[model samples]
Target: MSVYYFAGASIVAALCIMIVFKIHVDKLKHSPEQMGAILTKFFIGVAFCEVVPILLLVAGFATMQTGLEFNNLLLPLVCIFFSMIIAAVFIFLQTKVDVTQEMRGKVYTFAMIGLSLAISIPFFSLVGLLIQMQ
Candidate 1:
């Protein structure tokens, strides 16, 4: 129950971070090519950050339901495979979107910040789970 709440909060936080990034991106004047690159990098960062954690969290929940009967390595393998597939799709779609310089720096910065928040929340949730198990 609490894990679900934590997951929800993490998702909301990620969305907020993305909105902030969008606002920042809107403030700068970027050429179409620059916008496309920035968006591509941002999407890739986000896709990796979002999918991996959520899949791992789902796998964790599934394992918990099974009462520890599952092989530990299976979760990671599944998560990695699915995350890669999802990321490839995201990159492909983002490349198709018709849409930076100092803008490059801002884009990378926002991407990093967004990725960090997105990745960290789930990581902290993992840590909390570990602590609870101890």
Candidate 2:
């Protein structure tokens, strides 16, 4: 089914993003400052890619729904709130770590992967929803 295809594609996309992050982290080994800057920028880029499309989907949903129902707004609002919380927690954890250590590098990689998937999966699902709507 198309749903399976979408899910597989989403996973693949997440994996690719993780691999890129790992590569970047490896390359920026010497300068901690530059590493942090790149990491933050990468995180923001991923978050923007994942969030903006969903927000557009939400807007589309709002427009499509005739009645001004609270329920209609609830899902997107909740997603936005929880995403902010998750992002905050992720950022806090990342900043607390010293990525110079091998263990910490691994931890950071896993954390980045987790964050990427967390953002991507929902965005992809929302995209699927929007596609289905059309």
Candidate 3:
């Protein structure tokens, strides 16, 4: 149960951080090229972002001898892979659309929301489950 608490807390924290960052990007009204730049920054941030929560998750599993193997991590990896595919399609579409920069910015925002939700699900679920067991 305690592990779940920490896991859920990590989820909420991650979401809050993403939302705040999204809002900041919304203010920028970035063009497609600029959107690419923002995404690059996001990739960098995500690496740093996963560190603590991941460590805690592994620690919880270790304590329980949960036998959660690398295979268990596949769900989230798949989610992210799919999300990236979708985003790539949207970006390609952006090149085709003669839309304003502002519209492209909005599209990028929505696309990222989808991407973030995809990336977060499994990690949060692992945490939630640990919390539930306790």
Please give each candidate's TM-score: 0.43, 0.38, 0.48
Q: What lDDT tens digits, residue by residue, belong to model 2 across residues 1-134?
A: 33333333344344445554444545454454465576676667566545544454444544443334444444544554455355536543553545656446545654665465555654654455445432
lDDT of 3 by residue, 20-131 (tens): 4554355334444466666666556555555665665665555543444545445543443444454345434543445565576556564565356434644564544443
CA RMSD of each candidate after superposition: 8.9, 9.0, 8.6
Prediction 2 global C-alpha lDDT: 0.49
* Candidate 1 structure quality by residue, lDDT tens digits, 33-114: 3665666665665555466556645544554422222243334334333433433343333323332243455445544554
Candidate 3 residue pairs that clash = 1-134, 4-131
Error of 3 at 99 (Å): 12
Residue 4, candidate 1: Cα error in Å is 1.5
Q: Which stretches of candidate 3 lie above 4 Å from their native place?
A: 5-9, 12-16, 27-32, 65-110, 113-124, 127-134
Tell me, by lDDT, which candidate is best.
Answer: 2
The per-model lDDT (C-alpha) reads 0.45, 0.49, 0.49
Which model is ahead, 2 or 3, in terms of lDDT? 2
- Candidate 1 accuracy as TM-score: 0.43
